[model samples]
Target: MACNITKLPLFRSISSRSFASAANPKPIGGVCDYEVENSTVNGVLVTSAENNSPITRVSIVYRAGSRQESSDNQGVSHVLRLCAGLTTKSASQFMITRNIQQVGASLHCTLDRETISYTLEGTRKAVEQVLPFLSTVATEHTFRPWEVADIVGRLRLELATRPPQFRTVDLLHKAAYRTGLGNSLFIAKYNIGKIGPETLQHFVNCNLTADKATVVGLGVDHKELTYIVEKIKFPELAGQPINPSPYKGGEIRCDKGGDLAYVAIAGEGAGHNNMKEAAACAVLQKIFGTGSSVPYALDHGMLRSSIKVTDSFAISGLNANYADTGLVGAMFVAPSNVAGQITENVVDILKNGKVTDEWVSKGKNQLKAAVLLASENGKSVVRKLGQTGALTGSGISPNQYINLVESVSTQDVNNVLQKLGRNLSISSFGNLTCVPYLADLK
Candidate 1:
């Protein structure tokens, strides 16, 4: 969403329109600055911001997310995500862990359907002290067979503990795209132990390349970041060509019996390629409702406002953007007996919801707060900003994001709302006896 990039001395301005090859394959647009200056270094895209904060973070983001997985290598991304601290060519799992903890730094591996990011954060001097370890952990994965097998239990634990809402959204992606972006972030049970060391290595060799990655840093110098980035020996090419995954709507229902129903429905949304439209979708999500930001606070969201039943139910709008296409809609949780009605109400509102000037104004305010609050998590901001520069040719400053939000008018929001239910995808999980089918709804 947004990142705070405070000014630091000795930060020279470098002029750049966009990344060289960072967007080479599977490029998702939405090229705006993360309040960081962008530059291209040796074949890699580097984006960094200077700050006075003692904490510093640097992340190497590869385009190798779940979307990169093919039929033969499903769930490799999840396994790879868990394999972060495992043995690398340069260091053992024990040493990697020991060294990072020793420096009071944290190493994390996170992945979405689109990108997998490896981040190292600590005090500025501490990060500088172990900078090479970041590259070693990210690029030099050996994926020893024994080491890979040991983490299967961790995968199982993850799957078993996921909440219903997570499963519903994961299923929603499948119903929406059926492939590519539809791939699950979790490893399917069948693919559990089948993905061997070779499969892991093959996938990385083919999809994760230096040219297709972006380096992002916070509280760090551009020259220092660029210099280190050039030395990270990322995979040099000869991998699978990343393809654009378009949205194709459909429906899926998993009758996983339970007392409540988890349902998610969405329609085609604006992709990042169109800045105004994308920003509008962000605002539109807020307009419809994203529930209360205050924990344990009453939710008076627009989606909740229209519901007649007072039964325990939860609702929130969804807005997900990618390079080529996106999905916009809502998810609901309620007693199975009333699930259908709540879902119908959500769809009714989505398809016929009116976007007024006042609603749009409120949405802008909510969107601004959401972006700014998200930026508060320094690590998350760096991760989201990983590939922005590569996707779009250039960027705008922090103040300009407010300008972008302001640029979205009521008409633009309504334009997005009108697309709802056009090519809709509905995913329902849990006790689905009362959940309506896509055709059953008006």
Candidate 2:
């Protein structure tokens, strides 16, 4: 599965990478230069990105996600995501929504395999106006039984509407990790009966802790945000320590029976701990490219340029980093007739593709541009801080990220490629009858 750094709540439609090749790139809107303050007050980790803007976004980020789930509690994180705007212990759902709407604030819930974030964005006054409610929602939500049932129904509808890419990526995760990271983000239809309000509440109570959580403020006064966080009461619960899940490379195939076949070819990638290799993998992703800039455009990227596929097929490189492990790979979407050819071609590129100096320079610039553009949003800036702190126990600023990308050489790219060898984790969905198997690719 592709690591989707752009699929967040705020960055959905923002295609910042398109301008990577600009001869003279202009500074993006919002504050690029800012100060970050990290503190541990009463055991709660508080981080704030002070910047100039009328809008303030406060996010409560937790280290608990699907990776933290076990077989008994699979899909609890997804349930918790659905329960974000539900009733808190001190307030009703109606009052929470009415008050937020009254103040013209926006509330969003976003989660991945390793993290979950609940954020509120609006004017400073609107933020302060609803701080108490937001606090309750994050730290003291009362998962009502009826509300759980309602959200579960909505989740089912969402699952129905999800495209082939979602399923394909999900299957890819399953192939790569086998468990933990392999667990699907969307709750399985059968697992719905297994999860309930109590299950979600237990998961939250056991996994959500001050040490494993960070309260981040963006485009807001640090002093004010710190004060607000200080005044709020949080349960003094300790989180359970999670053992790292081993990466067992394998394959998962599903025949959804569609004209288009989806395939993911992956290998082991750098974990969050290996910052250098992770940075190198990021450069490698840019070197190979992820999908076409425009629809139905081939030769728009290294992967597309190298893979001998017709216009009816598409290929892109994908990399996902986790706290303890990662996945580096490519995905292909093509008519079933040529799915095997496209899959084999992609694997061939990963195994023996050459990395030139020109590719390295271009990839470095593209990675640098992506880093700068991603920092444009205050929310993203703070999210990075929380994620870094949660995953790696440190934060990477925009300048630091640019420097890291700048230091990536052709040798580093080649080294990363060598590390991600031919022992690939493969997944194929949608008319898998025409897709190639792992052994068949060889």
Candidate 3:
């Protein structure tokens, strides 16, 4: 449900919905109808937040991410992201860059496992002058063979420079879901330059349509965004489907044989529909610990056993929520000699330990603070706005965000923790001599 919502207004019914909609037909003049407003303009999804800040961010978010790729079109998303701002059907790369930079507006692209965004950022007036570029870069792609070939080097550079931890997490997804959500964010080494123009076009035709797209704005008026979205007349196709990502917990190890080891162990968690459970899983991650809040100081809150290692070891709870399902557990970096001991100990605590009220309270506070901080930051706020709107169909306000954190209870936290580690998915990189296998850990 990306943006084809019709009939019902998509904006959250915050205050008196009937009164607000009737009294305030405009987007910004007095009191906000809602902190975040969600609506549909001519069958296209629009989500936005109005603020007094000078900076404005507008993104055309499409549900076509790496997960949207098919077996034949694997790694097409990676190629597609690099192809952004290239010679689109409407404008050349030089024209797009020069116009955006002339107005001090920045046009950029970002991708995650589930979505891709082409965003424009600058002052309101400046952004308005260059807003057309955003839509052009996002929706219109010429994908000339030569231009597409130029990005091959960039793709190689990205994969070659990835850190060990990143590689480990990539493998972890492969072990967890096996496909769909498990698809690698980076292109496969063998497939470089293999994803040609035809495949990229095909992938977009299937998944980058209006039914799978969301128009998101921050510090910009909703009406202004609505007008822009309506004018663009986004492309749409009916009945697009994706491979399901079901949790099939297992082990994936990358035996790189380094002195240091990177490990991520996880189990099934909540999904997008289970908001409360997702919040509870977040709390459980916090209670187990999210690393040290203080710079240079190690976290002594959760995974307390890691503290006694005497050698350097970093451990933080992992919680990820996706459209269908999620994964939750811990990820750590430690000396290869001690990786097995630390892994077993962390597993023991997550599966057998009982969380106290004090830890739960602390987790709530930390989680709330994080939410507030993200809500306030200009860059993070818009990204969150775009991501949530694109994925959930409705956006969340800062207040609603904090309230979600506050609503989780001690029982909820404990219940979520108790369900983890049932069938662990483990991914690690480094010396295999000492690091234990999933069979060994189980």
| Residues 206-246, model 2: lDDT tens digits | 87777787788776656665666666666677897874777
Per-residue lDDT tens digits of candidate 1, residues 1-442? 1111111111112223112212221212122234577888767788876544457788888777888888988899998888887888877777777777787888788788877787888776667656667777778878899989998898898889888888999999999999999998999998889989999888788767877778888766677678667656778775567666888888999998879999999999987688789899889889778878789997777787889886888889898887667889989889999998898888888778888898899999998887776666666567657745545533334556778998998889898888865678999999999888988788
- Residue 103's C-alpha lDDT in candidate 2? 74
Per-residue lDDT tens digits of candidate 3, residues 1-442?
1111001011111232111122222332222224899998766679988755667778888877888777887899888888888888777778876777777778778888888888777766667667777777777777899999998888888888888878888888999988898899888989998999998888888888888888988777787678668767567665268668789988887788769999898889997778899999988888778877899876876885444677778888888888878888888899988888888887777677778788899999999887776666766776777777777888788788778989999998888777875777888887756778788764
lDDT of 3 at 118: 81
Against the hidden reference, what TM-scores do the models get?
0.90, 0.90, 0.91
Reference-based TM-score, model 1: 0.90
- lDDT value for model 3: 0.77
Q: Quick one: RMSD of model 3?
A: 6.6
For every candidate in turn, the CA RMSD to the true structure comes to: 7.3, 7.0, 6.6
| Model 2 ranges with Cα > 4 A deviation | 1-29, 292-299
Residue-pair clashes per prediction, in order, are 2, 0, 0
CA lDDT scores, all candidates in order: 0.77, 0.75, 0.77
